[model samples]
Target: MPTHQIQIWFTCTVDDFSSSTLAQTFSTINENIQQVLNPLDAICHKPREDAICVSQLRNAKKVDEAILQERPDVKIFLPFRFLFWKPQDLFRPNTYNRFLAATGGDHVISLIDEISFRFPPSPPLSQIDDLPQELFCNGDNRPADCGPNCECVHQVDIPLNAIVEVVLVDEVQSPNLSHPFHLHGYSFNVVGIGRSPDQNVKKINLKHALDLDRRGLLHREFNLPPSKDTIAVPNNGYVIFRFRADNPGYWIFHCHFLFHIVIGMDLLFHVGTQHDLPPVPPNFPKCGHHLPPITFDSGYH
Candidate 1:
């Protein structure tokens, strides 16, 4: 649903009675939206230097950049200037330790709203001969020891020294909360930003076609970008950025909100090969359960 609903729609009208608080809020919203758009002057359309558009959406289907160059009919990209998507975080050494202590290894929250979206989904116990019996399903024919449905935390691995491009879409599941995404080791250049596709529910199954259209639009619309380590992914909005995966360690990508974190909006990037990484120092204190026995003679498993 979040992926399908990408565009925005709005209505404006002056009310007979006025509330100062509501007026200020609406005015701020109008300015923020306008700031995200680019100047439409002829000079502004001149080619930019040192910036490359990501020709693809690197998901399972692997939408590539060639499409942008190849297709002129797609209308998803509208011109955009990312000067306003700036990072506004502040450093506070006074609360650093307190913040760290609060977030220490507290991933005990239960995942109650998980789903497996396989069409004509296979039974958990269904098996093939080549792979280990326990590889996908357990003895009871359940998906895992948890029986039929144990979901692992979602994660992404970026190859060492590789350049990374990430496209993020926000649906604002929680009201009044913006996720100020922060990466631990490296910052990113905000290369492109675009409006959501008209998220009409009936248009959802039209996702693949919609994405192709939307991405093409973003490619054509990209303009005057900015770079940063942290930026707000506005509620019900989208952002696209790029960075090099040179940080050879397990780095975190998370929201700035303390409460939002405890409930588990987090992702980890295991960058680089084990050989490319530094050796673990002696007695790096173990966390709960340590790690599963990893047979990594070449590098970390």
Candidate 2:
């Protein structure tokens, strides 16, 4: 588990008419807090000028100031940084209502691995209900026909330490959002992204297909180690990475593209122990029940 503190300073200006909506907004925030934490205890919701300050994990005055100055109704704000014993992802539902009330979206930060104490684990189905239907109901083009366990195999755990290898390749071209990429159950290391100039682009009439795998310029670079969640890939370059897939679960590795993924450009990875993958379903051979071989080849095909 890793932790990142996020301070959100936001102002909700209220006019006479805005009061009703504001009340509704506050109700949503308060409900989230009650459902997730003890309001009088872990969570705090306070008003500051036209703003609200929310601190999770370590606090930074700079993050607060920058967020506040983004608007005028905002006023003084600061967060008292603190580290805790058990690292509950501060992003979990309702842990911080002030931030929720302000951001009004599904954004959160991991503060640590595992909650401080184990309560009766919520039923898996209950947790599944909380997830967006598109995530597994297949609206996202995910193959999960029904919810978890509805599929033939009941395997539903994501290993946190299963080793994985990744390679990202890009062709020389003007930057454009190419694909909506996604990792499986885990994120990986950000090795680096290099670029090369293409004199070929300067010429016209010599028709050229934009190759997404052309390599060489050596522009911006990153060398961070592995972690969980999304890691960005450059628009016109390559990214190489490695990660562990210790978690045992059915995971999807695909571009986030809603339609593109439905067509193709999506694959799956099974990070089981060194043991060979289970046999593919007799009926759906194209579905690939096993892991794909890891290769880092890059070239126009």
Candidate 3:
């Protein structure tokens, strides 16, 4: 007989389960099976009373204490920062700049430079004498379907069979939520996932990560990275993935959440020129606008 090793993982408040018949059943099962507790699995109300407390993960008291110890001058404004705390605050460019300044991070850029750097036009690929002219639609020059009003259609043109590395930094809109980003064309290798080493820093923003990367503090597991098509980026951390742009076509990479995609949390990867792609099938359906032009008659019918 094959012995089975069972483990029960609780993701919600166990107190809610304790008063029910299910709790009794679980209690009986606990005698034989192992029960694992992970505070990061769920959000708890009255964490101190709960068996799995999230205090260690998101303790505002600790953050305040750290801030007071590091920068005594900002002690007066701590209450103000907390009083008007908003989720969108985390995404502001100034928030990153402030964090970099506070942490003594060298890799700091101005708000305008950061915006331009992050959302720059697609770069031209290295010239190849044998290859034909490149063809693709990117942010700098979008297709007709992507009109002046279409702010969501961000695109990047990639050379055929080029090695690409993508580092996704979670802005931490919500500490509990993780965005599962999915790429349509290719499955990439997830090489690394980590945050700042400093225990005092509760959250790791993009600037912090870039600074660490610049200083060679971050490590990549190039030898044995797991290949995945979709990856759930950690909250307040970063995920590094790499893949080859072997497929030649327009592919979408976006957050798995339908609502997030609707609101423009997506981008396109245009790989290779149109000549690199295979011929379309005879009955391949057409896409984009195909409205018939209207002609006004001089005489009434």
Candidate 4:
């Protein structure tokens, strides 16, 4: 693929565009065409600690000290400062983008620190159909365009037996937040995770040499094993997971960071048809709907 030569020609006349904007956009189209390029590092690496905070993390917190003592490789636990000038889909008229601003609307979007999720000890999540549908999904299945100022987004529904590939990204704005997402009801095969700004590769099988070579790299692996309920999305990086829709029920896929979900970094997948839903437990007890307790620790709150 690297040995190929490609050409592109574009022409814009005075009638098609205003002169000022066109001049600003087209003046920087520099291209040094090459017949060959260097091979990319098969393994993806995390951003360097020096590159974590935009200001270089001049002031250290107790949490930072504690993190250094424990996970020394980790610099800090904060959402990455974005690189793009604005959030994706900022000007759309969709219900999701109704409240967004130029810089994602809220400067403190993922700014919260330290969170926890605790369920009641009695009614286990396995109770399934017994709980109110609200417990599984807060909003009905619809086209929820989360953006500019949205606090929460809508859930996605999938038919039974359908196969889904979730491409979760750190996004251009919060590129530094490393989310360790977890999927309920089913475990998925992680395809790959990488930090390259521009990555392009076709899906490769796990047993193939391309997959086997990634087993040891600390960065992203091309062929990742399929046993984890949760996996880390490297800071300033991304990861992809694939799963089948055989688990006919409502399930939540969210970042392991409790605070991220609180600020709306979550999604729901409804597997199969309504007929696929199992009846509630026969002797289930009734109780009011409840939201779990969240506590902020360290200096994060």
* Best-fitting candidate, scored by TM-score: 3
lDDT of 1 by residue, 1-301 (tens): 1111111111224652358745654454432221212321111212333222221111222222432232322111111111111112113343211112223332222111121111111211121123233433211234444522233332345677665666555543234444667878886656544334444632112233347445664332323234467866544445556666767865666666655454444454557655676555676433332347846577655
Task: Write down the TM-score for model 2.
Answer: 0.31
Give the winner by lDDT: 2 or 4.
Answer: 4
Lowest lDDT block of 10, candidate 4:
1-10
Better of 1 and 3 by TM-score: 3
User: Model 3: per-residue lDDT, tens digit, 1-301?
Assistant: 0011111232234555566746654654534433222233323222332333211122211121222121122100000001112335535664432212213332222111011112223322222222223233333554456422233235567788766767777664355777777999897765556555666777666566677777866545543344568876656666666677779886777778664454445666778887897666677544433458977688956
TM values, all candidates = 0.45, 0.31, 0.50, 0.43
Residue-wise C-alpha lDDT for candidate 2, range 1-301, written one tens digit per residue = 0122111212234353366765665454432221321111211222222221111122222222222221222111101011221224444675531111113333221110110111112222223333333332211233434321111111223344433335444321224543335776665443333332455544211112123223323222121222334533344433444445555545655446443333323433434532333443456323222457867668735
RMSD of model 1, in Å? 18.9
Off by over 4 Å in 3: 1-152, 290-301
Cα misplacement distance, residue 213 of candidate 1 (Å): 5.9
Scored by lDDT, the top model is: 3
- Which 10-residue window in model 2 sums to the lowest lDDT? 110-119
RMSD in order of candidates: 18.9, 23.1, 16.0, 22.2
Full-model lDDT, candidate 2: 0.31
> Quick one: ranking by lDDT, best first?
3, 4, 1, 2
